[model samples]
Target: MGIENILSVAPDLVDEVARLKSIEECKILKEKIFMNQLTKAEQEVFALAIDGHSVSEIQGIPHKEEFTIKNQKRSILKKLNTPSMTEAVQQFQNLHQEPSQKLIRTS
Candidate 1:
């Protein structure tokens, strides 16, 4: 329907639609910010860290030396704005939380 027709039929719906559009825009901005903050290598390191891999194990991977892996870990922490490994893992996990999983809690 045209804007004028929609406005005449339901003015309140226009406001709601605008609000939902704003929310979706914010989500897209946040995702872009997160992606821009991390380098490709840092993202790989972050994923491995989330998997509970040790530094040595990461170093064992092709093209990843100990120094490079350690540097990537530091960069990941910096990009995620987290101080510790635990917090970094938690932050990454939180970003990927499923809608259903968000409703569940463990005591």
Candidate 2:
């Protein structure tokens, strides 16, 4: 039987399954990030950029020079194999959204 059939027998299983799936997805995403060879600093920069932070804003957050932040962003793009910050953000969003979309569709 499929998960939906099993879920109908025990409605309480829904939340637990969703939680476990979320954890598993997080682990997989971390593995992907590690495989991309980004330094911790570069990862932070990538996240900030994904959140729509500008180079100047990212610089202010890290108290770094604008040039340094720009370089970091460029490095993040290279490591993630993305052409630009916008594409990188889209890629990240797509990665994270897949599990949620699956859950929604199943529900």
Candidate 3:
């Protein structure tokens, strides 16, 4: 994706935040955001990546260490099929921002 696409999505995210409807909806979004794209650990790294974290900084996310974090980063990029950290972040954002992908909770 290009910078233009990223900018276009920012407004949509803002709309989403401003329009919190229900906890069920939130849960659905989380389920969909992760889906098959990442494991919980990789999802954590993706969050840190979005926050502009360094490899060392990502490693130090409370319970995580350098080796595990580094490994997760590589895994996330591979799953995202992105060649760089920046591209991974962008793809992550794109995947999560779309409400159409929301997952249904089953009993």
lDDT of 1 by residue, 1-107 (tens): 89888768696777667665665565565555666688888878767877898767778889778888888888888877889767877865665452332333322
State in Å the error of residue 87, model 3: 0.8
In angstroms, give how far residue 28 of model 3 lies from its true place.
7.6
Model 2 TM-score, 2 decimals: 0.60
- Candidate No. with top lDDT: 2
Model 2, residue 35: distance off in Å is: 7.9
lDDT of 2 by residue, 53-100 (tens): 876778897467778887888888887788888887887777655655
Question: Candidate 1: lDDT of 101?
Answer: 23
Candidates sorted by TM-score, best first = 2, 3, 1
- TM-scores for all candidates: the values are 0.53, 0.60, 0.54
Q: Count backbone clashes in candidate 2.
A: 0
Where in model 3 is the C-alpha error above 4 Å? Answer: 1-35, 95-107
* lDDT comparing candidate 2 with the true structure: 0.74
Candidate 1 vs candidate 2, TM-score winner:
2
Q: Report the error of model 1 at residue 64, Å.
A: 1.2
- Against the correct fold, how does model 3 do in TM-score? 0.54
TM-score-superior candidate, 2 or 3: 2
